[model samples]
Target: MPSLPEELKDLESKLQHTLRKLESIQKALDESTIVVITDQTGKITYVNEAFCRISQYSREELIGNTHRIVNSGYHSREFFKHMWKTIGTGKIWRGEIKNKAKDGSYYWVQSTIVPFLDERGKPYQYVSIRTDITRLKQYEEQIKYMANHDDLTGLPNRRFLREQFSKLLKETKEEERLLAVYFIDLARFKNINDSLGHSVGDEVLKQMAARFRTVLDQKLFLTRVGGDEFVAVAPRVNYQSILAYVRTIQQMLARPLEIEGREFILSANIGISVFPFDGEDLDTLLSHADMALYHAKEEGKFYQFYHRTINQRLIRETILESHLHRAIERDEFILYYQPQYDLFTGELIRLEALIRWYNSELGWIRPDQFIPLAEKIGLMPKLDEWVLSTACRHRKMWKQRGGVEADLSINLSASHFQIPGMAKRLLSIIESNGDDPCRWEFEVTEHIMMQDSAVVYENISQLKEAGVKLAIDDFGVGYSSLGYIKKLKVDRLKIDRSFIKNLPQSADDQAIVAAVITMARQLAIDIIAEGIENETQIQLLKEMGCKGGQGYFWSPPISETEIELLLHGAE
Candidate 1:
């Protein structure tokens, strides 16, 4: 054994070494974590550099204060009370805390509070170690918000709407109030989106969301369900009140919205379903409202309510759409020609080609019934192609069978002119079939001229330049714009059958017909009075200076062979 003095020196050396290790540990903790020490009364006694830096406070400022100096008030009093109770009983407490800095900025921390106990196992002072988790909490909150809100418009998303729907339904039931679910669809929004780029489309949607917000009252909530569609929920409303709200929505949306320095006149078809009357559940109510919206769009109306008849109509339409997809390949469509004659001489002037469909399953569908359906399902282009091709084939046959030098009038869909190179495509179809453009007159409605598309104007101009005859079909019934008439420089204005059906018998019809004829003559355009069924009507049209017409009085729309016989006799 060594001497007692030497042993004392060794013990002192070991104590110094241990003190150095403890100081190194304290420095590491100060650098890596926010460390603060307080007395048994919760008054701060010391704070490390990390604590002062994270709290945006000087050590001198925090030394005498409690943790309440940085309290954010984000937690309930009970939360802090429970935390203090745990540490005050000589126990360590672990949890997350939200705290505010001296600059009023908020932060999050993962905190562990430890109590230093006295010999009696009672708390003396507390030490808190915290790790900053502000960034992690922000990421979590961002994800949550993204899940519940629309990124483009900052409105509640469809998922959030569905989540809140049940709660609202419960409240509505308890309060004995009605709820109206409005399915609003923007009309012709596709045209805007397709013609312009998506950036403009997105801006349009954002502006619409802002406008919709202006109309929202305390009882109403609006949600963007998807592209060009929004749902408005109105609670505590009766039928009349719901209608009033709909009118408000209509009027608010009707105001012209200027986007990207261009003005757009917007309209929406609103479909409404009242609670406990139309449906009790969200899905059912939304479905019914959608059905109403479909009917409103079909009927050219602003708003409609749910009814059972719409369900049946929707079913038939769904079946028809499915069948129309296979119509061309199945060769279920045919063209019938109706002859136009000179009213004074009873001579054949031209043949108007009308389409007729005989589906294998749905037999003998009228043109009026299937034509609009075809247009709705985006099959108009294909149907128009078929019509042009078949009409050319018939004209070729007529020429081979010693035909007269009369034009073949074919009604064209307004959609045809929407294509960029529509004139070239159409003329290619006719020329490929060995037909002359001069022998064909493409008849278009007055609404076709109202499209305001550069493509439409370009196509019409191209057709006119290529020697194809253009005529305005159903003239008086549509929006009669004198500008469109003069701009198009059409070859003929076919007097709408409505004015001619009454003829000399009805003075209003005669006055309308006579006015149309006079205007056509002044414009150097020919006029054809259609739906003529008697000698008196023919004489009246001749007296009005109308050149030609076609109706049941001369011949109904006849078959290819029947019109071919008429063609031979006309020669």
Candidate 2:
């Protein structure tokens, strides 16, 4: 026992060297990424520096703490249950997880967890390695947003709407709540662009988007389905609630907008469709809402609830819409002119070019019904081009006839303003028609002027340079400011029918009309009052020094023949 052999002494030195290597490995493990070793029960036996750094806890603090110490509460309890089941069966589990740091900050990590088995293949300890990937997750989110959102309005695009609609349909049950889809189209946005320019039109769209946001709850999902058209999806709401929400939105939209010192009163036509009641699927709901929206636009401004009759009308509309896509190619669209009279001189001053669609199956479809539908479906631009080109041709023809000069006013929508090269396109249309831009008047709403002053200014400047006349139609209903009015290089302000209908009776109404007339006079802007029904209203407006007036009291919106007859008699 006193003396050892040389071989035994050599074995002892080897053992000492092996122990040193093991100690070095243990030190390396302590500094590695989220190195964790736990007992089968998931009690922490060891945690590394990296784990402490990510979890905001010291090794000592985590050693006695369970895995729950870093739980971010993001994963469901079932997630943890499944994780435990897998590890208990001696399988490795890997996944990305969100965990709370020691200071309550959150981090995302890719984790690989392994369960070690004893000699009998029973569970012993578990080891986990994790790498932080929060930045990567953020980048992924950014890319997703770019793909799903409208670049100009920052609202969900049509693609996103379809995806969300599918998901929502799956999640909602027939009994749980009703789903409603609202189709919104801005009224007369095109007129604004034609007169003031696209820059102003784009500004109007942005402002409208912002106002649309305010009209809904944070939970409401809104999407820009097309130019000047938005779809709002209200999930888990009752019919009453949906109605209330739409009313609120209508009120918000009707609120006057001020831009460049001009007051723009903007109105929207909203159509709504409910789930189960309207359709069981996303496509049907959207289609029906679109149909209802068209009817609302034709009927009047504001919102309209969906009904089954809308579906019948929708089928014809779909046919019309499908044909509209090819209408330009087929040459099935035509321009019809209606003359506007100079009240005092009894002569035709201008002619408004209106679009009419002749479908093979539907006969002649009036623009009052289909133009808004085209706009909601993104066919307005094509329709607008047709109107512009056709009107220019007609104007040239009229000019060739005995020096007959009549200004042409072509209606445009807000969406057209957002299109690139709109100014160039207008100029090309004018040149192609061989018509003078100086004799053309583009009518727009005040809301477009209030949307963005810079864009409005630029577009207006371009149009003015092209020698086009700018007119603000449906005025005194939008947010108008003297400042914006001064900035807008418009020549005319047309009073809206709502004000005209109530004029000379309600003190508030009188004040609004008086104020508008006064403002226009000061700006040297010509005033045209629309919707005069009674003689008293006409007299009141004429006494107020209004320049021109149009209404049922004089004549309803009629054909060129009637307008010519009226004008000839007056002359």
Candidate 3:
């Protein structure tokens, strides 16, 4: 061989050094990256050590097999088509892909595929460089899941609900089916959460979510919107089918739950709105459903369907509720007295005080309109205080001028008793007015007696101990147990007006009245039939051995001045 020239020798040395650098680069890539070389038709020709380790496959097993051996089926066929089209044209394709290993575990990779081209600009082979990003992908998925699900119950959350609502709405409309959106509020959930700790509450919520899931069909979606409130969206076949599904949910949730060795019987109030009927938009539908829920809770119904009248009524109530906070400060409240008479002799025995509101902006709002509103708005305690103080003031006025010989009966709100030591506070109000507590009767609904609260029990006990008379108003219409009546040692059972309105006519009402009277007599408790409108009802009550009654027949709830006139006639 001829000896090389100096220029040729230096050029060959540089070329050798450049080859060494390229080899070093290849070695570094093989160690760090999952590298694979494939023929133009996608037959795997070579796989680096990193590719073998990540794929849990030997080089021999991966080679000549193509990348399909690691296909996870996560990416769509179209996704792979796009990548192949790009690489086939001698362009680099960069993307993230999910692949399965030989052990059947899935891994994610950040991949870049570069096509080696012939001089004709056609691809002859492809080299793929992939970075194992399985952990990062998992972390991203975890973040996405946490953002869309509730932490306590691990249920899809409100944001997820909103996102899915549009899709569900579109599907329902396309199928010409009704999409039912159920807004569920767990009744008495706050009481449980407050009495028992949040840990117990959280466990109860989780159990509730699990039970809810068991009842839901695969097409139905349940999301925990917030504390003790969940929403379910489902496509229904018809009105009847949706109602049947609602009943099924009610029945399922009615089953008793146990947590931390304590058994709980829970109930839910559900409000529903249907797409294309109640509303067409997500926000409108959800708003209407929430309005229906308010009415469900207000009317004490298990579930309520959305109607246009509910929105109107809710709007009016909302306006009234806004003004109600100032009604007390504005002195818009007044009390009217109705005489309770002895059934046989027509002698006035007691005066029932009824509250009425006369707002300046909204004139003459009925007690039926604002009393429950007061209770709902947490104004009952303050209103009760005003009633107590005002009643005492009126009695002091009546006694100073040839007094009336009748006990003053005032209706007490259930929420008033929820306040701790409220009974003592009320007694102090009566004492401060220099009135005789013995001459006053505090009447509460039978529902109040059924509340399982120490504060309510203590309040009732304190009132009874202070020589104030206790009466169970609306006796037969509520959930008050016979044992509760006996336990409270109530002085009177006021038969509800419903039974009295159709008395001596409807056999059911008559039987209920007679049974209640007999039960009250056997319990050695006094009974009064209210809403007495006719002599026939009065005569029948006398025959039933009822001693006292009050109704519109004798006198409608009257002003204090009119009550004084009735007192003069009685005297």
Candidate 4:
């Protein structure tokens, strides 16, 4: 118990200091890393407290067991083979590893395994260190999902569609089977958007997409390529089966959708194209499907299959669409004036302006041929502006020629009607051309008005306030209720030619025409009969007290020069 020598005392103090340093190092390692030591054969020998906590196993349970006990099965045999090759050669192996816990939960880690070497420089034991990266991996997976899926409908997006289509097409070709690519368009969805508003329209689309996904079965892949447009691919399908599937898809789309307590029915135009038959490539297949969809809508059918004929029509339409913008710049559009007369007096009261395109290369493209194409390509607004400005100028010139005083009626397409500031734009065009707003009338069909939007009403109100007359064209051909017509506050109603052509012979037509005239008179709205070809139809119209009329009988659509001679003041 006596005091020791100074040298021995100093050695004892240094030993105690070294032992404390080792203890601190061990504590630090226990707190930070998930450490495990295994024999070369992968049997666990030691595990730190952190490792046990992560794997939900006690140290005693982990030791003496194989590392395979915690295998998540997420990695392939090849992955493990590469890992083993690295560590077995006494080299440090680093990788991201996913492991399963005792309670069947998963975790991710960035791991490093260091192999301990024997005298022969071969591995005898391995020491592993891991940093828990489960949260980071989860975030990465979520980001990937967002990138591949549409935010609105939660369906696969265009990017994902292309990826899957590429993979699926390869698989189909290898399996020697045909694949069907279907392009679906929600018909008249714009009417819903414009009338009910975008919010309701979104809900309707969601409902449609949900129904489509629900009934599609596991074999088909559905994607939302864009607004109101969905693309789907069905593998291992043939002509008969593909046609049956299309019929089912269309019926599903046609199902009623309830929005804001009202039942709404939706219709879709579906276009189908087959792999290797339509085209072997993705772009070609999509293009052919789109063409078939256009043809389906053209034929007023729910679905159409791509054929060589559709390809030809699509090429022609494409050429026309590509040139429409230039057509306006080149002054290829002309206006024809169809004169309306007093039924009894044959007095020219008004002239309806019709647009006819004279493409320099194509030579006189029909309005029906190019207008819908123009509308699709966003050229209708400009084309409409050009037509209106030209018609106004023609009317001004007619006035200069022989004092023509009849109102000039120009048709405003639905595409132009949807423009935000259409009324003000029209007013500017009218005043610029030295045309009287009161003497110039705008014709909008009932189908356009049936949309019943606040914007439409506002535009109409603004036009009328500026002394422009508005008429409901093709009166009975649309689905508008009488309430909408009353709300329009238009100056006149033009009886659709359908009712007039068979008048005085067909009882139903006679009754409808008579009722329309009587209603117009009661409402103080002037009625004009359209498409009067013979004298008997004119007589019947005159007797019905229809004050104004226009048709082939008076004169077919005439040029601006011919209009001057037809003016009452000229003669």
Q: Score each candidate by Cα lDDT.
A: 0.88, 0.79, 0.88, 0.86
List where candidate 1 sits over 4 angstroms from the true fold: 1-106, 112-128, 191-200, 260-262, 276-281, 398-406, 502-512, 533-540, 568-571
TM-scores of the models, in the order given: 0.82, 0.58, 0.88, 0.87
Candidate 2 lDDT by residue in tens digits, 207-233: 888888876877679998877999998
Of 1 and 3, the candidate ahead on TM-score is 3
Question: Once superposed on the true structure, which residue ranges of model 3 sit more than 4 Å away at CA?
Answer: 1-31, 39-41, 81-92, 114-125, 190-201, 254-266, 506-508, 568-571
TM-score ranking, high to low: 3, 4, 1, 2
Better of 2 and 4 by TM-score: 4
Return the lDDT, model 2, position 417. 62
| Model 2, CA-based lDDT | 0.79
- Residue pairs of candidate 3 with colliding backbone atoms: none
| TM-score, predicted candidate 3 vs. hidden true structure | 0.88
Q: Give me the displacement of residue 28 in model 2, in angstroms.
A: 5.7
Models sorted by lDDT, best on top: 1, 3, 4, 2
For model 2, the stretches where C-alpha displacement exceeds 4 angstroms are 1-32, 150-160, 170-176, 188-215, 254-265, 311-571
What C-alpha lDDT, on a 0 to 100 scale, does residue 556 get in candidate 4?
91
Task: Give the worst 10-residue stretch by lDDT in candidate 3.
Answer: 397-406
